[model samples]
Target: MAPNMADDVNRAVSGARPRLIVGISGASGVAYGVRTLDALNDLGVESHLVVSRAAAMTLSQETTLSLAELNDKASVVHKIGDVGASVSSGSFRTLGMVVAPCSVRTMSEIATGVTSTLLTRAADVTLKERRRLVLMVRETPLHLGHLRTLTALAEMGAVIAPPLPALYAKPASIEAMIDQSVGRMLDLFGLDWAPVRRWQGMAADAPE
Candidate 1:
């Protein structure tokens, strides 16, 4: 069942909604980022978003959402080069950061402290503050470099989650699959979601 927006917003304002910072990289699964923002908005969570240049290209390719439409989903949106953003400071309190559809290039840059832009810098701040950092890496056929970078980030306490769907959830549509993956990513930072189905064993007395 879909959550009640009004009630969820109220709960989000009260205690459930963590001050969240969402970053979108240049990956193919732009839908995951859109669904994540929608989920957060439904929960009344205040969000700060940063969209990379490459993300804009991918968004044009992957989804119908216009730049304006995408920005509307967040409470605040920052340019990728906005170094003056609040999320760049350690004093600016946030529950954590999520990089949906995190590209391999982005992952390597973050893992190596290459803060060439605001998104990378904010991720750096997230690590320095020891807050939760979830990267939904969207790559297949992982090579040695990809594995090495992911391992390094994991050692530094980043949750390296790939956008892999679960068949057990019985998703009926593409949107459902995206929701399930993004919902699980949010769960890492203690966000509550009911849109994604949890794992449950098969029924009793099954034929064997």
Candidate 2:
């Protein structure tokens, strides 16, 4: 069993903010990953980021920011191929792993236990260590393979979250929508967020 880093931290270290590992796959919703890192940083959570080669390609095609500028947003950044990194080990405790905009290819790899890169390895380590592993899969028009992989991962304790919007939030802009989605994702990990409005329901006294 992996030692709980939260439990083992000294008082001095324990005072530091929690760390979360954010991985970006080659999926279309790179925006989700970028926005998620920004939101986590805003919440004072330290983030370690890893971007796959395909993800880098997509990011370049989709966003104006350079990879370095993107990496600067995170507290620490690791290359996707760096399997020797601290995140690949269970000893380096993290709050959890979130693969925002996870591609179908990446999901298949995770499902099959294929750790060709550090991102996959870290995810694998997360599962083996029984830590929270959330994958925000971004594919649309899903196929049988995608469904099977999602099912397998879910069975293995991975949360397969897609980048679907909530109709109730009634977001005004793309940024707002992204924020709401990221906020909902964080909620899965028991993190409170103020990025989007929460549902308070109708006032009890005023409601019919």
Candidate 3:
């Protein structure tokens, strides 16, 4: 192999940990992103987090956790404007990026490749690298424009994973339901989170 190519690969793998980018948008249910970081910590996977300004506002409105508390869950935190961060480059190898609570605006930016912030830029890099880009959009009552934008993202090979409550899990609280959804989202990256309620066969529940 060429020396330059070898060096590039080496630089991308400079760290020992398998990295993944975490983007928290302005959409509600910031817990999805929070729990994602928690799961990454449990799995020993490195997390690079970038939070949009709007998301910070949502965080304040939805939960009592401070911004510092939210950032503490991540392995490494990047500013929303820091486009020069390692994650902003595709050569920085990783498992890819996931935007939990992806807002329609962020989704549209990524879909159009018109990234104006570090969060969307990192996602753009992930897509350009042919890596997995998962967006857990948290909006309901979707209009025609929203549907079209989602279709565009899907066409670009990005997964649109909306966080929906699973009644079959028999979740006892709102937290349980959120964990279930976040756990399922992690499944796309092959990360197994313990909080997820698996579906056993009907025979397993039946008495012998």
Would you estimate the TM-scores of all the predictions?
0.90, 0.90, 0.90
lDDT tens digits by residue: candidate 2, 71-166: 999999998878999999987877778999899888888898977999999999888877778899998899887788899999988988897887
Question: Order of all candidates by lDDT, from best down to worst?
Answer: 3, 2, 1
lDDT of 3 by residue, 1-208 (tens): 1113233334435767677899999999888899899999998888999999999999999989999999999999999999899999887888778999899999999999999999999999988877778999988899999999999888888989999998989999999998999899888876788889998757756787
Q: How many backbone clashes does candidate 2 have?
A: 0
Q: Rate the local accuracy (lDDT) of all candidates.
A: 0.84, 0.85, 0.88
Which ranges in model 3 have alpha carbons more than 4 Å from their true place? 1-15, 204-208
Model 3 TM-score, all chains together: 0.90
Error of 3 at 184 (Å): 0.6
Candidate 3, position 11, lDDT: 43
Error of 2 at 158 (Å): 0.3
Off by over 4 Å in 1: 1-17
lDDT of candidate 1 over 100-204, digit per residue (tens)? 989988888899998798998999888877777889998989999889889999998788899888888989998889899988888876687779799787779
Steric collisions counted per model: 0, 0, 0
Candidate No. with top lDDT: 3
